[model samples]
Target: MLRRSAVILVATLAAVAGAVSPASAGGPRHVRGTETIPVYDYGTAIRETVWVESPLDSDGDGARDRIAADIVRPREARTRVPVVMEASPYYACCGRGNESELKEYAADGTVSLMPLYYDNYFVPRGYAFVGVDLSGTARSTGCEDVGGPAEVASAKAVIDWLNGRGTAFDASGARVTASWTTGKVGMIGKSWDGSVANGVAATGVRGLETIVPIGAISSWYDYQRYNGILRTREYVRYLHSYVNGRPAEACADELAAMRAASGETTGDFTAHWAERDYRTAARNVRASVFIAHGVNDKNVSTGQFGLWWDALAKHGVERKLWLFQAGHEDPFDVRRAEWVRTLHRWFDHELHGLRNGIDREPRATLETAPGVWTDERDWPARGVRDRSLPLGDGTLGAGAKGRGVTKTFTDESLREDALVANPTAVVPGRVAFLSAPLTAPLRISGEPSVTLRIQVDKPTAALSARLVDYGTGTRVDHFRSEGVVNLATESCWGAATATDDACYLDTTEVTATADHAVLTRGWADAAHYRSLRFTTPLEPGRWYDVTVPLNTYDVTVPAGHVLGLVIGQSDPQFTVTNDQNATVTLDAGRSTLTLPATGAAVTAPTTPQSITTTTLPGAAERRATDNTPVVPLR
Candidate 1:
């Protein structure tokens, strides 16, 4: 697709076909390729540091903010090549990659080491690798706004400087320009790093060609707030406090502003949240997106990617998606070889101008199950449709035929582990319904919703639902570090030097045996069921129609396993927003559970059992769990 002479195209094709030209040949400027022969010595690679100026004065110093950027490039290149950049706050605080490696500086104020494998692998292959310390993190001059305008603009300013539209200064306070490289750029990162890439891409910067956001957040509001419920209060302030390089008091006012504007107490969507949401600006994106996410991610949540993908589709943006069976993890850790291979082809096709057929391939690659991957033309599996199942006395019926019986349960400060135990037995704080053991496999490819016609005894009550797959099976134990463990042995990916190496310790999946797995969950405030922007206080003892949407999922329930629906007060795993302990009564005939289902039609549910006081083996823990849930380390 590139406009070039036949000789140049054939040379590039030869490089793409694995017969990379010798190092003597001009690296990328003469022949476009990122996976080409090593044309530069990494030991002698040029390392430079710069501060890019932004439009805002986020740190209140009466001067424009400047973002710190570290660059590593091939010293042999005489002509312009492309760039692969990562803008992150983790370079100094949380570090990056499996080992949490932080940036190491040389005594001369130059970069002694670039963290992660990007510089070691790509710099010698012709791409300049730039690592930027986001605003308020590391050496950058600004306050961390969690994905607000200041953080986003700080990243965009670096890209602007690359495109000759912004100002940048060297360590010696002399102005510097990116005259040695082409303006085309690609951004890549994980978690908060990826979240920043999403924000910058949403700005439609002129020089940005593509982005690879791994386990990133698309909306900060959705990150800590699910539906109308607050997952954790003041999460933004906590994140800011962690990333800021200044003293606690130096950034105290900024953190205070974040908490005051976040509406954590009311759990409402306000203009403050809108400023951090990238989906609203998806239409402005000119760069292509390649998203990688853990289907069971709880830190950022899986809903972030689903809604962002939908919005990208709405705007006809070119994109590709990879859904894995982990939580808050990087594909590089889950699928290393494939990750490197595809990313090579992707960067080549987008940045290096290689005429690869990646664009013509399937748009989605999903790990349908453990070690099972499939490529599909579209997501939601193409034939997926919403299936409505009625809530029976103690069963999930296939049709709208349910006895006119009412069920009651009281609100309790129970965690997800306690609320889902012994689903068939009697429990005071939660009510559950079960479907027949499946004769065939049933898969759900998207979000699920639960509707209840209930009357609460208090002014406000917490509404929570869990979709569980009930069967003894092997599944990713996300509670144990996002389904991976770093081993002692290591594998090399690219070139190495005396100080920096491309080799990293390998990782493998973490799985465990389980009787029941919670596929997805949802929660909402009964008072905010009407709208997320404002609260409509409920009248005690009055029936209200409330619907809560569970987090997105793509999972299959095997034969001989039953689908279970557990309705409870809240999952203290995220947070217990309400502590009213009020009683709730619901009409079974009017309540229903809707799933994004495909495969097998259910005609009836297995008969019900009488409610008893019997509980699981750990009766005390099943009734009221005292063990705390693991918080994500991101």
Candidate 2:
């Protein structure tokens, strides 16, 4: 496993070291106004397949891997077109886009059908679309390691080949140069495809002009774990096995190696996780990044986007963000027309070197309501300030209430809705705190955190915290994985052919009118409260501090709504709990909950959870912790 990880790291370093500046071939071109227009025929677009050599031999077959690139370009484009690329493991397996489009080959061995709308819409707009199969998936070679180094290098190799830094061979075993392209590239996709774009751009690879990562993961560890809490076991093996369509016997060792190295049980921040985390590589990003994510996405949490966004900002990278209310979805489905036009202008400005003013626009777009969007200067609402309200017996306020009160609960797994129902009641496994109704609308713009001084009768427990909004309103039904339901009708964006089309089934938002909604929540292991990278055993009855971070979000609670916080044990929906059966006690006087808000103050009464009628069900909650400054948990 160590040798395999080393191979990946070494291959990545070599690929980046050999990179050079992008160049143009200088051929016929056409344009209208400030943007490139659809001046070429889509049906007559050139389709071909090429295999670019990879640097990693992940299969240990004594040969380096080969990556398959499927291209669709306008026949009219001799050399003037830039490229839009998508590297993925799903082309042959899970498929791509909302309709699950797959590739079909012609008798001449060229691609007769290219999957997504990129080939249809952008090829006619003077942009070539290159869909590269991830190594070990589809027609590509080597073992697929999920978001590991081999997969990353394979995608970057495509960018290198486009810029004349690497070599490729066409269908006839003939060497082919990318003289047909200007070497300006923009990578875009959703889910794992988007994650590949992120990894490639993080390499500081030359010729990668920009990237659009929608509903993508920034860290593989965060994908399966939350702060030290493992959400699922053996996902490394499951995902790699799922994506690799090759015979199982071929990559068995590769899969086993990944599972062993992933720290699937301990849930610690091990070397395997550090290697897949992109935040540490944010400084290497040279391309402009336009990121899109759903605040409610469960497949890939918002923390992946939030932490990555923060790291990029600190490095002074050119970036923009779009946060929606849907779960694990694409913004195109939410606002199709605006998204297409906005994406078109973004590519034009970044890849074509046009002055489209996209970079000068506001840096953030957030969906404040079910269908309403707002442009903001930055995320977490620009002027967000950290406001800490001390936890009381039943109230949260500046004035201390519950000075000597101690609250106890047994560490047991329970559904969040059941624990939060009628928040004022004395639930067996959870505690609740609520603030008074707000006088003005409050917009929570950044990550919310909680601190608790707790004592457990056992060595460890799973600590969960939730932030909720208490009021009736129309909200995105995040529990529904499909943010939008597809309809029978279709809408076209570009020209179509017999095998492929530029149109897709129309979709509408799926929403629910509810009295409350869980905005964000987080979970952590009590033993790992001190360090997400390491664990410290408790003395059983001694007090220890723990900090749990809720996923990042941007939402406005109306003036009439009340803010509530619920502290509980294991949340069955998202976590695999220790089931320690330990009795946990929280010191109310020393605990604090900090939030970022635009307008409005927070106040609450004492003893809401201890009393039934006084508490509000489906209440707001953040997190809890002890006295020590827990480093790197968030």
Candidate 3:
């Protein structure tokens, strides 16, 4: 990764070196916007620390809150240039990037180790880079509201300062302004940091020309719950501590307030969650968006990005996407050179108003596997068709059942691995249905859904659908690893500072060659089958047609691979414990599994212990704690 970046950097340097004037001191000239600005040398860029004032006082401190910004910009610029900013709460705690590098404060109270390679790579390219510490984090004041208005406003305030609409101060408390910036900013980050960009963009902040949210959260509600089913009852509280890194006592009131606001008890979409949901305000977004997400991201999940992308499209917002087959990870790790070059061009077009023709390219780029990427006009590719496969006697077919058949499973405690392991295994806690080995490859490009027509014995039941690809093949092992192993040797991607090195260990992790891979999964509370904000309990002996929507995915199933759909009550690895072990009776005649298959046909045949139709008794319906600054791998 470093070697590739070095090559790109060397080329970039050569281009800039030729542009330098012979009479100029150490300044290089680059044509951006309407001016030929004197760019500061990469090795001698100005690094400074300042505090940008924010409008919120979330911590309730006597004074107004401030955001800590570590900025690197061209020292010899005669005029303002564009700015690249990253706002994050993780800097003071879990650090940033795959290496988990933290902020280092010099004895003079200036900062070093400014997270990722953004500053190292962009500062010399004639852009001012600002690494902002979100409120109540690192050197900033106020509390972290996760993705609420306070956090959004804190970051927005920095942009305002750069545009001369807000105030900033130096170490001596002297007023400072971003006179070196053109007031056009491009925000980029992964996970929570990226979410900040999403949140701020939804507010339609003026100076923010574009944003790149990689593995970012579009809705905090989705991050903690799925279709009204709680993914983790304590995730918000856990995240509060995880990002703060301070003693619990320091932010007791803030944490308490966050837990109460989450409303995990009912898993409803309250106004509190609404404040953190960017999709609800997507129409107000003025910035062009470049989104990247891992299709197999279990942490922030792909649904967040998909829903946000859809919203942006609906509002006619210019957008682009990079959908990878990896888990919660930054594209810089997966596609280093290409990611950097594309991102550079994207910023140039958006912030500098350069006619790079990037907006004319394909709207989406998808990775079928590691090292295999393809471009599409849009996501859920235009010509894909929904292939409806009905449940038959141990088979998936297009024909309706002649008689009512019921498949039952107890809502016993079981993990995802146990539920998806074997196609022939008649698991006590779940029911598995498989399609016949595909005669040809089929690519699934969008959300898949299942309709279960059933009557439950109890009032509530948790429904989990696992879309599995059962075959011996080398697939993207997103569930088990970061997919990269650290190499012993080191290399550099950007220019380095004395205390903050721009080099990271060149690493690689091989994709797992496994017999089976869990392609996509989704879960919902039967009560939430109606609406996420409202719960409707089931009436005993009465049939309810429940539609469970699975996660969004982009994958091509290999020929001869058996596509299987496993439905059950609980995944012990993901959801909170629910003790409602209700027997679920499925009317196979009325039930159907809908999938977005790229090709035309889909079929299934009977195997031992496979689903078969007949009148049957109704059965029961079911269902990383580490203090190590665990890297958000996806």
Tell me, by lDDT, which candidate is best.
1
**Model 1 local distance difference test score:** 0.80
Which of 2 and 3 is ahead in TM-score?
A: 2
Candidate 1 residue lDDT tens string, 1-634: 1123434433433443355455434444435443444556777889999999999988777899889999998998876778999999888888888778888888887777787878866776778899999888899988888889989999999999999999999988999999978899999998888889999999999999999998888998888787667776557776787778776776677778888988878888988899889999999999999999999887777888888888998999999999999888999888887887798889878987777789999999998877789999988778899988988777885853566878998877667777887788887889988887788888888888999988888877888899987778878767676777788765666655556666677888888777778899888888887888888888877889999888889987898787889998866666547545878898888998988988866445656543222222323422342323322334
Candidate with maximal TM-score: 1
lDDT of 3 at 557: 86
lDDT of each: 0.80, 0.79, 0.77
lDDT of 3 by residue, 19-86 (tens): 44443344335554432333456556787999999987777766778888998887876667899999
lDDT of 2 by residue, 1-634 (tens): 0112333433432342222222223423545545666657767888989999888888889988889999998997755689999998988887777777788788987887777677767787789999999999999889898899999999999999999998899878798888889999999989888888889888999999999999888898888777787776666777787789678987999888888887777888888888888889999999988999989876677888888888998999999888888877888777887788888889989887878788889988888888898898877686789889888875665664868988999966667667666776667888877887777988888788888889998878889998888777888776654467787875665555666665677787778777777788888888888787887878787999898888887888999787788898877667765545778999988888889877887877433333233232322321121111111100
Stronger candidate by lDDT (1 vs 3): 1
With a 3 Å backbone cut-off (N, CA, C), the pairs that clash in candidate 1 are none
User: Candidate 1: deviation at residue 290, Å?
Assistant: 0.8
lDDT of 3: 0.77
